[model samples]
Target: MGQSFFDEQRDQSLVKAAIVAKYFDAWSRVMIANAARGIRISRLAYIDLFAGPGRYKDGAKSTPLMVLERAIADEALSKLLVPMFNDADPENVASLQSCLDSLPGKERLKNAPLILCSEVGKDAESMFTRARNCPTFSFIDPFGYKGLSRGIIQSVIKNWGCDCVFFFNYSRINAGINNDSVRHHMDALFGSERISRMRAALIDQLPHEREVFVLEELAQALKELGAEYMLPFRFRRPDGSRTSHALVFVTKNPLGYRIMKDIMAGESSTEDQGVPSFEYSPADARCPLLFSLNRPLDTLAGELLSRFSGRTMSMKSIFESHHVGTPFIERNYKAVLGQMEVQGKIVANPPAQSRPMRKGERTFSEKTMVTFPSRAA
Candidate 1:
């Protein structure tokens, strides 16, 4: 028999909770900063449709409580906070309320004029429709995949400048997409009956490739909903046998994308010194996961070389063009540029200097000129 939905919550992964908390905290900081600069953002609303009992049996806080605490800690966010937590189970709703009532900093949150509520229901479409008017951050994390409908997601995003982070269980899709009942759900989730074509195309492909194709299809569907930028983080079972799911983020704002990329990179539990990557290990796993803080310098360097070979451009031009929402962050470009200089593949030029910079170190600024070397010398 399949695991019970409540049992799934009780057995939640710490790595997943950590990732979600880090991203939401970082995103909140970015939005608060933007508002401080007079961006006129009215409010920061957060809605979690499948919010579990706010705390798991293992004592780790779930996404709903984590987000609420992050907002309460930040004064700017606390003042503009409008949050709603919902679950299909009334018991879970009551548990969430108890968790909220017991949270620290009640005095501060009470003074902030927060608009918060918990509903005992599974009415995600109605809740999403109501969230369409503000600068919202919605979390749609459902076990398996039944509660999230594509039409509701599309309408919410198309109507406002909101951001969403949710899970796409391609493993479930791979198992069920061929079944008639499951195919009906897939069509509703993709907002199209064209999944038959996708299934036909993936029939002879490798398993991993089939997952990739499914993810691409999902990303494309999200793009059609007016999401200008989308990012996906793949997750696997603790044993690393097969991909369990992928966490996807969608937003129309470049800053939102940038912030999320940084958060994802930093929070990734990879030990490599070059590019940041993440892999999940269950709480009961034999081996503990290592968390590292490496930037994607190697990947960024290669991407820069590939895109700018034989071309000269200022740092401002390069950053504006590439760093707005890619895996290569602008802050890490200095390190990448330094590595490129060491390899003689590119030259970072100071203002008004045409000579290739071959010094002890080059500090990249907006005025710095970067040229991809054309000659071997």
Candidate 2:
């Protein structure tokens, strides 16, 4: 990003930073909590390869600074968190170092924040592909798709507790698909054979359809590499024209996936009849319509009814089992299940009172399991 982007910290970028920082806090806490309970976690690392100037020109802190500050705030986190910030640009590195130097109580962190001025390409990929000594939370944000590759993502999240969040420049990569000059970069990104197929498949497709196809292709490839859970938070252009980029979160743990989905959903601009768009549109600006009568939940309800026709599970279990590749969050599931219980479509019980829910406790919480009607019923 340029100084201009840092000038005011664009709304969309701010949203992106918020999602990452929130997830980092939540994820790191889980690790620390588990270790407190005797789980083995010797160290934790937060790596940002394309770390920009730590503080924006307008005085707001970006991801790198925000992360370090959080570590500084918590004693337990300070003991376990090791943050590394790297940028290919010398100017950014210099600025970021200055900011890091000025951070109050910087030495409280386990490791002095490691700031590097290095390109994120072959050498970096090679380094990350090897076995990691500690569980790391990596954030890969590039101005463009130049330095990012599949191997880096695969390697970062291949371990026991490692997770990755990367900026996917859809607009740029889509345009560069057939451009011969950047073909090598494209090959590195999607693999040579996959890129070829993408070019052929994208022929005569509409812009939006092509965008969906490309995102899915990348997600599918990541899954093939064993990154089981992936969630995307999309950003629209300043003019609200089309998708400009997205922050894609990859993880192997269901808990991590659930955490990110909630954070991203909270950052979303609008909810359609209670279902979030999973997008940040500058035009939307977090505003709600005065009145919305649409019942998109009807569609979700039907899908759930069909899938669980004769089944039963905890709301939490149902969520983990169902919401991998879908946009529906946990709240969405609870809302649908609650409605189904009321309308006699299915039975949602808290597993103890009212017959289950303890006389008056009727919330569809994570522990509350629900039973669906049999096909014969």
For every candidate in turn, the CA RMSD to the true structure comes to 5.2, 3.2
Q: Per-model C-alpha lDDT, please?
A: 0.66, 0.78
For model 1, the run of ten residues with the poorest summed lDDT? 112-121
Write the residue-wise lDDT of candidate 2 on 13-58 in tens digits: 6887889899999988999999999988778888888678886666
Model 2 C-alpha RMSD vs. true structure (Å) is 3.2
| Candidate 1 residue spans exceeding 4 A from truth | 1-12, 107-122, 142-147, 271-273, 278-303, 323-332, 351-367, 374-377
lDDT of 1 by residue, 1-377 (tens): 12233355333355566666787777677777788898877777777765777887667788877887877787777787677666666677778778888888855653332222233124555566555566777766533346556666765566445778876666776777777776656776665556778878988999878877888888877777677888777766656556777788888777777777777776554534445554443532454333333434557877877777788998878777777545565666766776677677787776224434446554667778889865343
Q: What would the TM-scores of all predictions be?
A: 0.79, 0.89
Output the TM-score of candidate 1: 0.79
- The ten-residue window of minimal lDDT in model 2 covers 350-359
